[model samples]
Target: MAVKGLNRPVIPFMAYLLAAILLAMTPAICLIPLVDSVEVWQGLEANTRDLRAQTESGILLSMGLVDTGLKLFDNTLNHEMEEAFGPVVAEYERAEGNPGAMDLSRVREELDGRMEIYIINESGVIEYTTYLPELGYDFREIPYFYDRITEIRLGGFFSADRVVAGIPTGEFRKYAYLPSPDHRYLLELGLAPSEFHESRMALKYGDAVRELVNLNPEILKIRIFDCLGTRIVGEECPDDDRRLSLVRQAYRERTTLEVENATARELTRYLFVDLSDNDYASDMSMVVELTYTTKAAEEKVAGMFARQGGVLLFGFALIGCLCAVAMHSLIRPVRNFVEDVDLIASGDLDHPVRVGGSEELVHLGESVSAMVGSLKETIQRVRASEEAIIRHSHTLEEQVRERTADLEESNRMTTLLLDIMRHDISNANNVANLYADLLATEIEEEAEAELLRRAKAGLAKSIEIARDVNTIQHIEGGLPSPGPVDLDRIIRAEIERSPGARITYTGRPVEVLADDLLSEVFTNLIGNAVKFGGPEVGITIRVEELGEEVVVSVEDDGPGIPDAVKPRLFERLSRGTYKESGTGLGLYICRMLITRYGGEIRVEDRPEGGTAIRFSLRRAGTGGEP
Candidate 1:
C-alpha cells in the first residue's frame, strides 16, 4: 500500500505561458528605455558643452587679440623711447654705473613730460631716477616685478611689459627694462599718455565679454570675477550672494562649476582662468561666469523623450500581442492534447484523444490511441481467459470432492485448482489496479481523490495476498526448504514499491532461515500499516539478531488495534476497527509465510500508540531459537 502524493494547484495553460513570456522579456523591456535614456542624455550633454565651449573660445580669442595688439604697440613705442634714452644710458655707463655723472636734462627735454627714466642697481633697488618719488624705492619689495628686473640684469636683454598699474600710485602706465653691458645695472623707462589709456581701455576684458554675449544667443549673460570674488569684467550688474559664493568656491577649488535655475530657465557656468605669468606666485586668475537660457533645449529634450517613450510602449504592446498569438497557436493545442490523454487514461476506452498540434504530437496522440485500443482488446482476452479459469476451477473442485478417499489424486487436483485460482486472481486484480491508477489521476476533488487512492491501495493489498495464496496452497504438497535469504534486500524492494509511505528502517547485513516468499510477510505488515493508518502514517522496520533467531518488528503510528480484535487478528477474513476495504488476507498471508519459514508471528499495541507486528525467524547458519 502506497500513500498518494498531494495534488498541486492547477494553473491554466494560457496564463502560465503568458506569465513565462512576460518574465522572459522583462530585461529587454526595461533595458531598451534605459539604454535609450543614457544615449539621449549623453548626446544632449555633448551638444550643450560644445556650444558653451564656442562662447568661451570667442571671449578668449578677443582677449588674445587685445594682448597681441598691446604687445605690438608697446614694443614699437619702447624701441623709439629706448633710442632717445640711448645718449643718457651711454653717458651713465661710461661713468661706470654712476647715475650722478650722467645728465638726463636733455633726454627729458627730448621726450617732453611723456617719459621718465629710472636707474636700478644689481640689487633691484632704484638708485636714481628722473621720477623723484620712486628714486629710493626697492623693486625687491614687489617680488613679481623684482623677478622680471633680475632677469633683465642677468640676461642683458630688453623686453617691454604689458601696460600695468604703477606701484603705490595705482595709475595705469607702460614700462620697459634693459640691462647694462657690465650686468651691474638695469635701465628702465615709464610712460603715461591720456590718449593711450583711452585706447587701451577699449581693448580690455569687459568690452570683450559684452561682445561675446551679444553674439551668442544661448549665452544669456557673461561676467568675469577675480579670485577675491569681485566682478572684474562685463557690465556692472548687481551681484547676488550665491553668485559671489560660487565664484569664490570655483577659484578656491581651481575647478569649473555649473548651476541651473529651473524657474528662470537659465544655466550659469563658472570657469577659472589664470592669465598672469605667475612664476613668482602672482595669481591673477578670474572666474568667468556664463549664463545660458535653457528653455528651448530642455523643451526639445523633453519632447524627444516623450516620443521615445511612445514608440517603446507601442513596441511593448506589439510584443504582448505576439505572446497572445503564440499562446493560442502553441500552448492551446498542447493543453488540449494533455486533457485528451488524461481523459483516455481514465478508462474512457471508446473516447478519442482529440489533439491538434505539431506532426510529432499528432503522431504521438495516434500512437497512444492505438495503444489504448490494444489494451482494451487485451483486457477483453484476459476477461475471456479469467472466465475459462473460473469454469475450470469449479470443475476441479467438483473432481476433488468426487475423488474423496484417493489421497494422491485429491492432492493433485487441489494443487491444480490452487494454481489456476491464483493465476486468475492475479490477472484480474492487475487489470483493476491499472484502471484505478488511471482514474485516480483524473480526480480533482480532494474527497473523491482520497477515496480513489484508498481503493487503489486496497487493490494492491489484494494482489499481494493473491500471489501469496500459492504459498498457503502449496503447504500441503510440501514447501521449498528455507535457506539464507537476504532480509534487508527484501524489505528495501518493498519500500521502493510503496511510494510516499513514510517508513524508517536501520539496515543490517543479516540473513534469515526463509525462502524467497518471505518478502510477502513484510509487504503485508507494512501495507497493512499504510492501509489502516492512511497517508500520514509513520512506520519503522527493525531487525534484531538474537542468540539463535532474528526478530523483526514493523511498527506504525496508526490507530492501535482494539483488544477485542487482538485474539483472532491473524484469522482468515479478520479486520480491525479502522476497517479499510480489504479481504483481511494481508495479515493472514504474513502469518502463513512466517509459519512456513519456521518463525512465529504476533501483533501487539505499541506503547506510543498504533500497532507493531513482531516476528522471529531462525537465524541462518544457526540452531533453532531458544
Candidate 2:
C-alpha cells in the first residue's frame, strides 16, 4: 500500500523495499545463534572452571611440600641445642651456692662452635661472653633476656628466629636462641635459608620451600606468617587490606581459609599448618598464603569474544549495504525538489525544476516554476527605483561643494583688508613723529617744546598700538609650529636687551614646547615691568619645573598691581595702571600665545613687593621635537 501524500504509482517502490528488508534479516538470523546460543555460554563456563581447578591444585601441592620441609628443620635445631648444653646447665645449678667458684669464661669457650654464649651474672650484667664487646652490657632492661630467662627457669631452652649483634664487628646475625645454665646465660644459634638444605637429613627433602616458589609462574606472591602474624619468610607480602584480613583470619582460627571477592583482582587462599611435632611447642603454627592473579582466565575469555565479534562485524556490514540501497530509492525524488527550491531562494530563477520520477515531485516542480516567474517581475521594479534614487544623491553632493567654495573665498578677502589698514596707519604715525622732532629743534619757548614733546609721545604710542593689533591678528589666524626652546637662554637674552631694568635670573636649564614666539612672551613681561615699576625697577625671573610642564615667573619690586586690575591684566585693551603711555595688548598677546600652545598665563601679587606674572608651557621632549 502507498503512504499518505505519496500519490505516485508506488508498486515498484514497495517491491524494492521488501527486497531490502529480507536481505538485512538474512545475516541477523544466521549470527544470533552464534552469539547468544545455550551451547556457547556453557562452553565458556566449562573452560573457566577447568582452569581454576588446575591452578588450585598446583598451588596447594607446592605449599604442602614447603610446610613439611620447614617443620623438619625446626625439630632438628631444637634437639641439637638441648644435647650440647644439657649437662653444663645441671652442673651450674649445683654450684649456685658458690657463684664465684664456677668458671663462666671457660664454659663459654667450650660451647662456642656454631653458637655464641653470654654469661649474665645474678645481677643481670653480662659478665662473660664469646663476644667480648657484650661483656659489660646490662641485660636486665632487654625484653628478650627476661623472656628467655623465664622460659629456661621452667626447664626448657627458648628457641625462635631473632636478630642478634656479634662481637667487636657488631654485625647483625639472624638466628635461633637456646637458654641454659639455669637462666644465668643464654646461647643463640641459627641457620641461613641456603644452609637449611646442607645437612644429609635435610637434603632428602631437597629445598622444597625455595623450589616451590620458583616453579610456578602463575603465582604472583606467597607469604608465610608465624602464630603472632609476624612475617617470618617468603616474598615481600602484599599490603592490601583484604589480603591482610585473610592472613589474620587463618592465624586466629587455626584453619584453612579461601577468599575471592568480586572486587579482588587475585584469588587468595590461607592455610595454617603446625610447624612443631614431638618435644617442640604444639601451639606454634605457620600461615602459608598463595595469591594467583586472573590473567589466565581473562586472556581466554578475551580470545573467545574476539572471534565472535568478527562474525557480528560481517553481519552489520551486510545490513548497512541493504539500507543504503533502500534509502536512496526513497530519498532521491525529495532531495531534487529541495535543491531546486534552494536555488530559487538564492536568487537564481532562470533554471526551472524538471524532477519527474513520481506524481508528488512533478506537481512540486510546477509550483516552483510559477513562483520564480512572479519573483522576476518584482525584481525589475526594484531595480528601476534604485537607479532613480542614485541619480538624486549625486545631484545633492555637487551643490554642497559649490556652497563650500564661496564661503572660503569671502574669508580670504576680509583678512587682506585688515592687514592693509594696519600697515598704512603705522606709516602715518611714524611720519608725524619725525615732524614733531624737527619742530622741537626750531622752537624757543619751554612750554611749546614740552607740548610738542607730549604730542610726539602720543603719536609713538599710536604706532605701537597698530603693531600690537597686527600681531594679535597673526595669532588668531593660525598658530606657528612648536618645538623645544631653552628657557635659561631666552631669559638671559631678554634681561640683557632691557637696558633700563636690572633683571636677575636664577634657574637651571630647562626646555619647553613653544616656537620662536616664546622669546616675545618673556620680552613683553620684562618691558612692562620696567615701565610700570619706576626708573629703578628691580626684576627677578624664576623658572620652575612641574610634572609635565614648566612655569616661568617675572617678579618686580615696585608698586604692586591692584586686585581689580590683576583680574583683567591679560584682557584685550586693559591696562594694570592708566598712568603709563603704552598699549594694553602686551599681556593679552602673552595669554593668547600661551593658550594656543595648550598652556595658561596669569598675574598675582608678589609676596615681597610688586607683581608676579606667571605662565605655564608643556615640557618638551629631550634633544628635539616629539
Candidate 3:
C-alpha cells in the first residue's frame, strides 16, 4: 500500500514557475507595444513635417523658374515682333489703346501666322490681335483672368505661364505679357507648340514632377493639374469628378488641401500653386497633386516587432537554461529516489537507493535505506503467503466453476419457466378468444355483438403479446444461418395471413439471404399496422434490389410514429404508443432476427402520412436472382 501510494502522482506545480516568470515580465512585455505605438506616431509626424517643407520648397522653386523663364521667353517674342514689323508696331503706338491707328492688316501679312500678338488696353480688354478671332475681345467678364492681366498691366516685368489648355476650348497655348513702351496697352504674345518652344524647356512642369518624385522616396506619384482641371504632367488617371471638384475648390481658396485615402494607403496632397503673382497667375496657377506613402514608419514598427520578439525569445531561452542547471541539483536526487523506489516496488529489493545533496535529502535516503532492510524481510514473508494464496486460489477456482454450473442451471430453469409461461399465456388467451367468439355469436343486439368482437380482438392481441415475448426472450441467442429464401413467397404468405388488409404488392420472383424466420419480421410489421390502422388502412409492401442487398419497406397508412420515438422503436420493450395493443417486443425481436441474417431494420415515417418498418437483406447469390 505504501509503495502504491509513493507511485501515485500528486497535483503538479508546473505552472507556478511559469506564472511567476510571466508576472515578472508583464510590465516589460506590455510596454513593448506602447513604445512601438509612440515610435510610429513620432515617425509619421516627423515624416509629414519634412515632406511638407520639401513640397512647399519645391513648389516655390518651380514658381521662381516659371517667373524667370517668362522674361527670357517674352523678350525673344518681342525681338521677333520688332524684326518683323518694327515700323508697323511703332506706327500703331499712337492708337492710344485703340490699336486702329496702324495698318495691322499689313503687319499680319508680314508675320505669316508664326505667332499671334494681342494688344490689351489698360482696362484688360483685347483691342487688337494678329489672330482674327480676338479682333475686339473683352476680358472683363472673366474677373479672375481680367484681374491677372490688370496686375500684368500694372507690374513692370514681362511674365508668362507654362503651356496650358484653354479654359473653354481645351486648346494648348502659352501666352507671355509685356508693357508696351508707353504702358498704353499690354503687348501679349500667344505661342502655339512648335520647334521654337522646344528650346524653352526651363518651364516644363514634367521635369519638375519627375525630379521631385525621383528625389523623395516617400513620394509615390506627382501630378500637376492646370486651372482648367486637366492633368498636365505626371501620369493620367480617369477623370474623378470628386477629385476635380476638390481641385477647383483649391483653386478658389488658393490654399493647400490634404485627404488621407486609407484604401489606397497613401495621403493625397493638393498644393494650390500660384505663379508670378497670386491674382495675376490665373492661367499660370495649378494644383500639385502629391501622393505620399509612409513606408518608413510602417517598416520601423515591423522591425521593432521582430526585434522585440527575438529579444523575448532569447530571454525565455536564457531563463529555461538557467532553470535546467539549477534544477539538476534537486531533480537528480528526487528522480533517483523515485526510480529506486519504483524498482524496489517492482520486486527488485536489492536495487540501491542513495541520494546525496541537502541534509534533508541525506536523511530521507538514510531512512528509506533502513526501511528497505525491513522491507526485504517483509517481502520474504509476503512471498510465502503468496504461495499459500496461490494454492487457495486454485481451490477457489474449482468452487467458482461449480457455482458457474449452478448459475447456468438456474438460467436454463428460468428459460424453461418462460417457455411454460408463454405456452400457458397463449393457451389461456386462445380459450378466452374462443369463449368471446361463442359469446359474439349468441349476442343478437348489434352493440353487444360489437363489444364481444372487441373483446375477441383484445384476446387475440394478448395472444400475440405472449408469442412476441417468447420470440424476444431468446433474440440474443443463436439462430439459423442465412440462406436462399423466396422473397415473394415469404411476402405473399405473410399477406395471406391478413386477407382483408388493403396490402399493395407487385409480386416479382426474387431470392434474398434470409432464413424461414424472415416471415416473422413481416408478420410483426404487418400485424402492427393492421392493429393500429383499422380495416380501412392501406399498406404498401415494397421490395427493391440494390446491388448485393435487397431493401424491403412495409409501410401502412396508420398513425405515424412520432419522430422522437423512432430512434428507440426497435429497442427492447419500446412500444410504438401506450394506446396500441400487444407487448413492444415484436419489433425488437424483428431487429434481432434481421441482425442475425446480416441485415438491419429501422422505423421511418412514410412520405404519405404513415409509419414504415424498413429492413435490408443480402442478395441470395453473387449473380442475378434465380
Candidate 4:
C-alpha cells in the first residue's frame, strides 16, 4: 500500500554510529595538547630549581677558597718575621762585649734570606742593611723604630716600614732590640714589603686565585685594618680614604663594616658580618670582602632553562606527532559516519554506509538497518489506514451535517412555539387575573373566592415563565454593540435591578468601550449570582486597567461550581451539579459576546470564598475597540 504525504523514510544505521565516534574523538584530541603542555611546564620548573642550587654552591666554594689562601699568607708572614728576627737580636747581644768582631754588614747579609732583613742598633739606628742606599738617613731619626726599641725592653716585636734596596716601601717588618748582658746595645730585623709580594707569588694556583678572587682587579684596591678598625697597610697606607671611611662608619655605629660587592652591576648582595668577639671565634671576626659579576651566574641559569625547555619541546613534539597519527586512525571511522549521516539528513537515505572496525559501530549499523525496515513497514501501514479513515470521515461528516440541519429546524420550531405560547399565555393570564378579582368581589362567596385565589396564583407563575423566555430570546439574539460606557454605572444599575442580591464595588470609575451590552452582561452575571447563591452571598464588582486592556470581575460569595462541571461551564447546555433553574446558555452567550469584541471571559473559584467571573476588554486603539 502507498503511504500518504506524511510518510517518511528511516535513517541508515551506519550514520548514527559515525556521529557517536566523532563526538568521542573531539575531547581526546583536545587533551593531547593540554597534557603535553603540562609536562613541559613541570620539567622547566624542576630545571630552574636545580640551576639555582648549583649557582649557590659554586659561589660558596669560591669564597671558601679565597678565605683559606688569605689565612695561609698571613700565617707564613708572621712566622718568617719571628724566625729571622730571633737570631739577629742574639748576635747583636753577643757582639756587644767585643766591638772589634762586630761586623754589622756580615750579620745583615746572613739574615737577609731569613727575613725581609734590615738591621737597627741598640740606639734605634739603621747601622747596616740590605738595600742600604734606599735608607736615606739613620733609623735613629725614625720614630717607629725608636719607639719599638724603647717599648720592647725584652726584645719583643713591632711592625714598621723603612727604605729597602733604595726604594721607600711598606712592609709588615718586625723590629726587636736585645740588650747586651751589659745592657748597652740592641739589634733589629725589619721585613721589607718585597718579601710579602714574593710569598704571594710562590703560592699554588696563585694566578687563578688572583683572577677569580680579586673583587675589582682593574681598579684593585686592598686595605687591611687592625682589630681596632684602623688601617695598617695598602695605598694611602694606614690612613687610606676608603679604609678611613670604613673606620669612621664602624666607629659611629660601633659595628664591623664588611661589604661584599658580588656583582659588577650596581646591584650587589652585601653581608655585614658582625665582629663581636664576645660570642664568636677571633678568626670568624675577620670579615672578608668578595666581589664578582652576577652576569655569569645569570647566563648559566638562563642557558640551563633554555636547554631544558628545548628538550621538553622536542619530546612533546614527538609525543604529539605520535598521538596525532593514532588519533587520526581512531577518528577516521567517525568522520566517515558523520558524512554518511549528513547525506541521509539531506534526504538521500538510499545509500548505505560501508561497515568498518569496532563492535559498537557494527551493532549501531544493525540497529539502524532494523529501524529503517520497521519504518518502511510502518509507513505502508499508516498510508492504508489514512485512506480508510478519510473515506469513513467523509461519510461521518455527511451524516453529522444532516443531523445538525434537522436539530436546527427542531430548535427553530421549539423557539417559535415557546415565543407564541409565552406571549399568548402571559396576556391571557393577566386578563384572567383581572376578571378573577372582579368575579371575587361580585360573587362574594367563600368557595368562589378560593377559586379566584387559585386562578390568580396560576397567573403569576405564567408571567414568570414568560419573563424567563424573553430573557433567553434577548441573549440568544446576540448582545447589543457597545460604546464608551462607565463600568461603575453599569455595575450599580445591575445591583439596583437585582435588589435582593448583595452587591459591592471595590474599584474606582473605569470607562470601557461598551454600551447597553455591558449593562446586559452585568444583568445576567448579577442575576445568576442572586439566583444561584445563598441569601448571605455578596456580589463584588472589581475593575482594573492593565497596560492595554481593562479587566472587570464579578465575584460572588456563593457555593462554587463542581470541578467536573467547571470546564464545561461556557459550553452550551452545560449545567452544574446543583440543579438550579437555568437554560445553561447564559455563560455560553456571555463568552460569545465578549470574544467578538476581542475580550476574554473565564470563571474561577474566588481566592477566599465562592466564584469569580473575569472578563477583559481590549483598550481602544486607532481602530475600533479590540
Candidate 5:
C-alpha cells in the first residue's frame, strides 16, 4: 500500500537538481586546496633563493675587502724598499767587488728591524743578511733568484711575494735589486707581516661583514673560504662538519644545494661561486652557506590554509543556498499541481484548483478544469433523462382515457424544464459577457485585452448554446406557422434595437414567410459583423422579389469566411473562420430558422470585398398575409 499525503516525486526531483548544482561547483572547490598548496611551496622556495643570494653577496663583499688590504700592504712595502735600498746600494758600490763590504746590520738597526736586507753575488750566494738564520743562503735554483737577476741585468725593478723552496710564507714581501758598480753583486730588500691591526681599510672590511651578519638574523653563519679551501675571513661554524659534505657537493656539481631539518625546522643552503677579484689566488672561488629557521614560513602557510578553508566553506554554503532557492521556484508549483490532480481524481470536481507556473502548465490546468465542468454537466443531464424516462413509463400504465392528459403533462414539464434551464443559464452568460466587454474596453494592455476578449467570446458561446437548446426543443415540438413578415421593417427594427453598430438600409415592403423569430436571425448576423469587423464597419441590407420567393441579403465589410470552413458554417458548434469566436450556433440557428420558414440560406463572397449572407423565403400571398 502507498503512503497517503506523501509527495514522493517532489523529494527526488529536488534532490536531483541540488546534486547537479553541487557537481557544477565541484571543480572550483577542488582547485582551492591545490592552489593553496602551490602558493605555500612557491613562497618557501622563493625565500630560500633570496636568502642564498644575500649569503653569496656577503661572502663576495668580504673577499673584496681582503684584496684591498693586500694591495695597500704591497704599496707600503714598495715605498719602504725604495727608501732603504738607495743608501745601502750606495755603500756597496763604494767598495766594489767586496760583497761583505755591504753592512746589513747598520741598515736593519736604522729601520728598527722592520726590514731585512740581503746581499747576493753573481754566483747565486746570499753573502750577508740582517737576520743570522738567513746567512749563506743559496738563491740559485729558485725562479725568484733568476727572475730578479734578469730584471737587475735589464736595469728595471720587479716585486713579488717572496716564497722560499716552493712554499708561500704568510708574510707579504717585495724585492728590489741594486747591482755593484761592476754589476757582479745585487742588494735585495723584503717586508714581512707586522702589527697592522689599526689599519682603517682592514678594520672597515672586517667590521662591515660583522655588521651585515648582525642585520639579517636569517643568516646563521657567513664564511669566506679561499680557492685553496682555507678560511680567509669570518668564523667557521661548529656544524661545519655536517654541512661540509653538502658544500663540497655544491662545488663539485657547480650548483647550489639546499637541505632542511625537520626536527629543528631549519633550512640550510650552500652556494659555491667564484670571487671576481682576489690578491691571494687568481681565478679564486668560495663556498657560502646560509641557514635559517623555517618555523616562520611554516606558520605563515598554516595561517593561509586556515583562511582559505574558511573562504571555501563560505562559498560552499552560498552555493547551497542558491540551489535551494532554485529548487523552490522550479518545483513548488509542480508539487501543488500534482496535489490538485489528486483531489480532482477523488471526485472533488467543485473544488477550485489554484493554478500558476509556466504557460504550458497553466494552460494544462485550465483544460483540466474545463473537462471536470463538462463531466459534471453530462452527469446532471443523464440523471434528468433517467427521471423523465421513468415518468413516461409510469404514465403508460394510467387509465386509457387519461393517457393523453398524462402524456401532455409530461411534455409540458419537459418544456418548462428546458425553458428554465435556458432562461437562467442565458441570463448568467449575458451578465458575464457584459463584464468581459467592459473589461476589454478599460484594459490598455494588449495581453489583458486579449484575455478579456476571449472571456467575452466564451460567455457569448455559452449564451449561444442555451439559445440553440431552446431552438432544438422548439423544432422537436413542431415549428410555428410562417406569416407575412415585412423584410424591410424587420431589418429596420432589428438595426434600431442593436446599438454600437452602423447599418445602412432602405425600407421596402417585400414581405416574407417568417415567424416572430425572423428578427433574431438578422440581429445575430449584424452583431457578428460589427464585433469581428474593423471599427467603422458599414452593413447593407438588400431585399428582392422573385415571383414565388424573395431573397434577402446582409452584407458587411468584415473579413470573409475561408472556403475551408464555409461548408461547416451551418453545422452546430462549427466556427466559419479562425477569426470567428463563439458557439457557431449563430449561423447554424439562422440556417435552421430559414429552413423552418420554407426558406433557404447560403453565404458568398461580395463583389467588392467582405462577405454576403443571403437567404430565400416563400413570398407571403394575399390569403395568409399578416
Candidate 6:
C-alpha cells in the first residue's frame, strides 16, 4: 500500500509557528512595564523642577518689593526729622540771651501734616510725639526709640516693640532711626509686623507650586523642610531616620537616587532645594521629597502587555489553524495524485485521480488521466500481440502433425503397392526362369543358355525395388522405439546402405538416447547427400558430445543449397531448386522427431562445399538408467 502524503508528520511546521510566536511576543510583553515606569519617573521629576522654579521666583519678587518699601519709609522719616531738628539745634547753639529758645511747638507744628514721627531727646527719651495726644512724654525712658538711637549709629532699620494709639494694640515692629544734625534729637519710623506678614503672604507662590505638585502626584512628593530636613508642608513623610536615609543621601548628594524595593518596585528620590534664598532665616532649606510608587502603573502596563500577549496568542492560534487548513487543502490533491500514480505503477491503470478546486491540480489530474489511458491502450496492444503469437504457434504445430500423418499414410500406400507389384513381377520372372531352365536342360546351345541367364537377372531387380520401398515405409513411419544408440553405428549403417555416395565417418561411439528413429534420420541425410551431391562429391559425418547432448553433423561436398531455400530447409515441402530430388519431408520429419525427444536440427552451408545438416540428441543416461 502506498503511504499517505497528508498523513505525514506535522510537528516540524507546528514547531516553527510556535517558535515564531514566542519570539515575537517575548520582548514586547516583558519590557512594556519597564518603559512605563521610566516614563512616570521622568514626568514626576519635571513637575518637581517646575514647582521649585515658580516658588523661588515668587519669594525673590516678594523680598524685593518689601525691601523697596522699607527703604522709602526710612528715607522720608530721616529727612523730616533732620529738617525739624536742624533749626532747633542751630537756635540752641547760637542763642544770645536765653538758650531756652528751642521752640517745641514750632517744631511740632512745622512737621505736623508731613509725618507721624516721634522726636526723642539726647537721653534716649521721647520728648514729644506728633501723632499722640498725650502731652509731654518722658523725654529719656522709652526703650524702643532709645535702643534704636543707641545701637544703630547712623539710624538704620531694626525690629522693636511698638504701641499703636487708635487700635490700642502693642506688637513687634520694624523701625528706622534718624539722628538730629546737631545731635540733640532722634526720629523713628515704625512698620507693623502684621503688614510685613501680609505683604509676604501676598507674594507667596505656594498655591501655584502646590497645583503643579498635585497635577502629577505619582512621582512627586512636595514637602517643605527646615534647613535640618524637617517636613513642614505637603504629605507627612517618614521622619528623617534610617528609613529616610536614602532621601537624605539624595539631598546631600543633590542628585536623584533610584532604588528597588522588596517587591521589585523602583523608587526614585530627589531633594527639593530651598526655594527661599534667605540669608537671615534660621531654617533656610526646604526639601521637596518626591516619592514615586511606580508599582501600580507598572502593574497596569504589565496587564496591558499581558492582554496584548493574549490577543497575539489568540491571533497566532487562529492563524495557525488557518495555515494548517490551507496546507492540507493545498496538499490533498497532490497526495491523491501520488496514490493514483502508485496504483497505476502497480498495474492498476483503470482508475483515474479526481481533480477539483485548484487549477494546478486540475491540470495535473488531466495529464495523469491521459497517461493512464495511454497505458491501458498499450497493455491491450501487447495482449493482442501475445495472443497472435500463441495462435501462430498452435497452427504451426498442427500443420507439422498433419503433414507427418499424411506422409506416413502415403508411405504405407506406396509400400503396399510396391509389394504387390514386386510379388507379381517376381512370379512372372520365376515362370520365365523356370521356362528358361527347362529349355536349357533340353537344348545343347551354350550361347542361348547364356542369354537365358541374362534374362533371369530381371527378377533380382524386382526384389531390390521391394526392399527399397519397405525401407522408405519404415523410415517415413517415424522409426522404431528409440534406445541407446551410438552415432558411429547410425553413420556406418547409412554409408553401407548407400554405396554410391562417397561417405566418411569421424569420432568414436558417441552414445545418444535414441532408437531406430536415429537410423532413419541418418538414412535420409546420407541419401540426400548422395542424390544431391555431384558424382565426384563426398560425404562426411562428424559426431561430438556437447554436455548432455550428442551433436552429429552429416556434411556433403555437393553444390550448396541455394540461399533462397536455406531459410526453409527444415520445413515440410520446402526443397532446394538444385539437382537434389526427394520427398521434401525428410529433413522436416527429422527435425520434428528430434525436437520431440528434446533435440534440435538445422541446416547450414559448409565452408568448403555443400550443405551440412546438424542435429543434437540427448545423451543416453549414464549407468544405463533411463
User: What value does the lDDT take at residue 560 in candidate 5?
Assistant: 78
**Per-model TM-score versus the true fold:** 0.38, 0.39, 0.43, 0.31, 0.35, 0.27
Highest-lDDT candidate = 1
Clash count in backbone of candidate 4: 5
Q: lDDT: which is higher, 3 or 5? A: 3
lDDT scores in order: 0.75, 0.66, 0.73, 0.58, 0.68, 0.58
What candidate 4 gets wrong by more than 4 Å, as runs, is 1-332, 338-349, 437-441, 481-626
lDDT of 3 at 497: 89
Flag regions of model 6 displaced more than 4 Å: 1-481, 622-625
For model 4, how does the per-residue alpha-carbon lDDT over 524-591 read when each residue is reduced to its tens digit? 68767866796678888888888778888899989877788878998876766765536666676678
lDDT for each residue of candidate 2 in 108-181, tens digit (9 for 90 to 100): 45655445555555455666555665667765554444544445434545555422223233443434445554
Task: Please give the distance, in angstroms, between residue 53's alpha carbon in candidate 3 and its true position after superposition.
Answer: 14
Listed per candidate, the RMSD to the true structure in angstroms reads 30.2, 18.7, 15.3, 28.6, 36.4, 47.6
Off by over 4 Å in 3: 1-357, 377-392, 413-463, 479-493, 505-519, 541-580, 587-626
The digit string of per-residue lDDT tens for model 3 on 335-407 reads 8778878987897777777554444555576677779889888988999999999999999999999999999
On residues 279-365, what C-alpha lDDT tens digit does candidate 6 reach at each position?
A: 111213344454556666666666666766676677667666766776676567667777777877898877656544445555566
Clash totals, every prediction: 0, 0, 0, 5, 0, 6
Runs of candidate 1 exceeding 4 Å displacement: 1-37, 87-110, 121-144, 167-170, 180-184, 198-215, 224-232, 235-626
Worst 10 residues of 1 by lDDT: 1-10
Identify the superior model by lDDT, candidate 2 or candidate 6.
2
lDDT of 3 at 193: 59
Q: Higher TM-score: candidate 1 or 3? A: 3
**Candidate 2 vs 5: which has more TM-score:** 2
Among all windows of ten consecutive residues in candidate 6, which has the lowest summed lDDT?
A: 159-168
